[model samples]
Target: MTLPITTTAQVRQSLLDRHEIALLDVREEDPFGQGHPLFAANLPLGRIELDIRSRVPRLDTPIVVYDNGEGLARTAGERLRAIGYTQVSLLQDGLRGWREAGGELFIDVNVPSKSFGELVESQRHTPSLSAEEVKRLLDSSADVVVLDARRFDEYQTMSIPGGTSTPGAELVLRARAQAPNPATQIIVNCAGRTRSIIGTQSLVNAGIPNPVAALRNGTIGWTLAGFALEHGASRRAGTASDPQRAEAAVAARAVADRADVRRADTARLAGFLAESARTTYRFDVRSPEEYLQGHVPGFRNAPGGQLVQETDVSAPVRGARIVLADDDGVRANMSASWLAQMGWEVWVLDGLTADSFSERAPAPPALPAPSRPVQWIAPRALADALAREAPGTTAIIDLTTSANHVKRHIPGAWFVLRTDLPQALARIPRARRYVLTCGSSLLAQYAVDEIAQATGAQVLVLDGGNQAWADAGLPVEAGEQRLASPRTDRYRRPYEGTDNPREAMQAYLDWEFGLVEQLGRDGTHGFRVI
Candidate 1:
């Protein structure tokens, strides 16, 4: 079937004119991270069916798929069409075409958001403190609070000594409570630079009287400076008083107004939802713990800081309208302010009450059921079969993300991408019986038909998947030992982990510092700093 082609120039102009568009690189994360157009989102060909609906909710939303001569774009386009995506197209000549058309290629993920953070820092001259300075302050017992502006899980893994888990949106709302005295200093940090810069700037923008500064280069700088980080830390921000919340709401609204973010009441939000021509994202920008207790119906929970740091992942469709909600009013306005400056048509939902949040739990993601029924093998039964059968007679194919596969899997399962089942079948040793499993076996169930077709052997799915194996007290293995596919599903972040090459970490920082210049060259990012 012939597919429409979107020229590189047209894609650029769409971005420049604030028209909704999803430029997708239909390659795995590793390759996509090596190089892609600034606004392009990496939605691998293997995951298109699983992720496209959420990423670009509007079936008729204009989408252009491309790959670097890997021949995946056409197949991706066809799959998208089959899944009811009505306006799918191919990028002319794929990645090479964009390069040839004088479009700038960016390395790493979330280029648009990261570059916008750099632009914010450049335009606003966001204040920052070096790791050494922060260390000295800690040593001196100065009146300061180090706020780690990352998710609680990330903060638990590692954090600055005495640092509290005050994520980005929570910064403005909680800073006053964390350091009630204006004389106390506040240093905000993240695993890397984006959240650090954004979090620190958020407090400044909200007119926090405390002297605020980002931990320059964030935790990476702390590690490089030979400082020891605390692990298993669980310190979290305390609830703000009614007075503090009221004060924060006022300050945050001013910041949002300065950034030109629009306000939408419940009626207006319903109207935005009814508009079929545009895709609108409804998000409750609050802590997950609070979100689970109760949240607005039809709104997903995305913490404010993470939403800004990973906009491509959270809302891939560029120029889509986003409506944010929070009962306190501080988080929504603060998060919307950043989103608006990042070129999104964003609004903060106002006139909310405790009664507005009626949903009590997170909604499950929509997924297609298994194409056909298949036999199921209990985890213990499978373990016994593996022990009793001859070597290579029973094989397990795992379809989890490469990262999760590396973390844990059945002792002898072969990690494989669902899309590469045919190719992978050829590589694995011949077996009389095959079993498929993933994190929960939901995705594996979808692949039962393909594997059964190719092998013609008795195919069974592991009941409850890998999780059940662990729960059943069965043995499992970690590390990448048995692999039928390359582990390219995830691109390792240079800023994560402690053992990364010093040069690589320094290179990452250098790259961020240069993003402003790159943005200037591209001229398509309609970012503004308030």
Candidate 2:
């Protein structure tokens, strides 16, 4: 069947014009990972028939599918037609065709958001003072505050010789308290660009009276510029009053004065819980490790930094009330302020702890049982399938980040980031069978589950994930691309070996626990938590 194909120029123009179109790349993930058009969703062809409908609710929505060549397009088109999708079309000649036609292709670089942050730093021309600049300022006795916008752990790990730990979001709220004098110049930085750009921008955006600029490229840039970062443990924890508690106190005061913040006592909180049936999103904004150990009932683990960084990807619903659970109020309050600024109805759930409500709160949700009807294949059988079908027919999908997939992956495997799975199914060739793998078996199982739920595709999981694949003595690829840094080029202080990693860890934990408690306390009142 001759399917409708959209050209690169047309796709670019559509994006430029802000037209309502969903760009679907239907290729095995590895090739898709090598590069793809920006904002293109990946839904591998094998799963297109099932998953596309869920993501694109309207059958009439313009859905453009593309593969490496014409063969996949035809197969995908046929499947869409069989599924009764009237508006389904293909990308002419696939991605190669798009590029051949002078269309722009975007590299699926890891840390694009972090990179975009660097661009913001460049664009805003946020200031940075080198050692020489600092020396001059100090010599002149200038009123300049060198604020380290990284975590307290990082500040202790390494910071500008005289900088104080203010973290990022808190810079704006605590600026008055920390620095006091509005005339003082504020220099904010993280280990690298993200926090620095974000921190400097936050203060400037908040209309701080002081001049603010991020240290260019952060500490790495500083080092490259022949400046030195200090590396002694900080004498004390950079303690600040908890914003939620402060806000609550302010609200309490308003009860007597002009009512600004509303205070909800236990009775009010209980009543609010009884009255509301809205879908509340409870996040345990603690480390995944901590979450795996023990967390509040019904709360999903979402690290605070990652939660802030990937809010759109994580929670698509704009109006959902988000309740953040942390051990203490600091991180939760910091996260709440950012979310609130972004127009989310966010609240810090305070006070819950492993000790305080262990038995009182509901039990943790039960883990879903494995329900695969297909018997596990033997290693030899899997090897024979790979030998026979891998070269031309079978597509191995490593549902990991492109960077990790590129670094080291199953030989002949394609990269399909979990985020792009929906689009891959819509655009990749469906004639081939698929084997899903990830860093671990759990993620592989997750991919299989998502695919099964979306489409009744005959997909199989790599039993042991990447480890199993390696253990099977299957071919593995390795390259420098596989190595990923625990830290970004941007400034972020390491928490390890700091004078008080435990104390810092405890503080963060307390903040996250407090947040969960606060959310349960708030329930569905006038304030939305998300």
Candidate 3:
């Protein structure tokens, strides 16, 4: 049980001394997405006692963890020191001591924001287009539009022939409502190359006079230029009340005040929500149906190009204090100028509106979660106990990944891994209402108290798992039908499922063009190419 360890050359010299280290792998998001290192962060050993204090909210910064030796880095370094984590360790020989110390391994799940958007398009040569120069400016009807910036379900999964969605921090307030003719142009695109080079350098760092670019390496360079894309499209970006929404809210508040970004106001945003040892967050970045029709009050909605492409899923506290919000000052100053170029201590809230909401509503939907208080069953009582399949009165089980149990579950529920329920309770046939579920049962109530202390089983957790059985219209059943477990925890990622194989998308863009020489030999990523 002796924990303190480290040295993949001191986590590559504490990310080359820019400092704040997380580097956690703790194995389980599909084998931490089949490889590790480029600033590793998965954090999965069955939700590390429920995502380590909001994913390491500074319990003395340095963490290490790592696994691939199977004995999960000394049980995730004794569960990050029994959940207090005042600097835990253990990597030294995990993932084979980071490839025998030469380091470099990255694959999938936000490899440091996709290798810092391929090192910010190899240092700012960021403008782009090329799918035959945006299909000859849409076959010469010119005055372009395009947009997409990944996530409207990845711009309706594969777009381009006319693009639209507008996700990444809403490209300077929805690219002036999708190109309101400042002699048009725009472009954007994602699904490869970090939200289209941070959504066309977030409308060229918010100076947006409509002439941004980035489609070049997106939709995987329009499927390596053979082109075609468009499945499901459904164009988007429509309401920031365009006509260049007040000059893109004054050039996105002068690029969030030249990236110094502060402006919380309201008495320093009520002393940053009463500090209490610093785990701030407050987000808004508009559009989850405009944060469910009204927002502001202690924010939460995180849309601003998927909050800078999932800042470790919305402020995983890499030194917290994020504020942001947006009654349009060009989307919380272009998402607080890319979360203050990703070092984050960002701000922008100077008066959010719809008159700063939250008098009543806001029940668990402003995302960036942290609530965990499970134990339930209602998706119509697990659809009347799975229509009385009554085999031991019920047996559900699921616990989530195996690629979301082959992309949907419940019809016959078998999946496992709440840390493999004590050898998965002998492949779960012995039930007495062992319900549990995932995809939002919040790790099925931590897999029903570890399958009720490993086999006292009366488990029941399915309240909103399988998205409350597909929002209660019920009836879901996809492949890998009912396996007690074999999907090796999670990895088939290669930027996740959709036609991949253009040699696995050009070997995932040649491993993001060798991640800036492996962040210059894993010299720790405090990454600042902005």
Q: Which candidate number would show the highest lDDT if scored against the true structure? A: 1
* lDDT digits (tens) for residues 4-77 of candidate 2: 87877776676554444667766655455556654465566644543554345344566788877635666667
Write candidate 1's Cα lDDT for 145-263 as tens digits.
99999989889888999999998899999999999999999999997799999998999889999999999998888888889989999999999999999999999999999989998
Cα-based RMSD of candidate 2 = 13.0
- Comparing 2 with 3 on lDDT, the higher-scoring candidate is 3
Residue 23: error of model 2 in Å?
14
Ranking by lDDT: 1, 3, 2
The CA lDDT of each predicted structure is 0.90, 0.55, 0.73
| Local distance difference test, candidate 3 | 0.73
Best candidate (score: TM-score): 1
Stretches of candidate 3 above 4 Å error?
1-31, 35-40, 43-55, 60-72, 75-107, 111-141, 145-167, 177-186, 191-217, 225-270, 281-306, 317-322, 325-328, 333-348, 351-501, 506-530
Provide the lDDT at 33 for model 1. Answer: 90
Looking at model 2, report the run of 10 residues with the lowest lDDT sum: 484-493
Candidate 3 minimal-lDDT segment of 10 residues:
363-372
Candidate 3 C-alpha lDDT tens digits along 53-136:
655655666777778877767876876676566778787778887887788786677677777777778888888877788888
CA displacement after TM-score superposition, residue 306 of candidate 3 (Å): 7.6
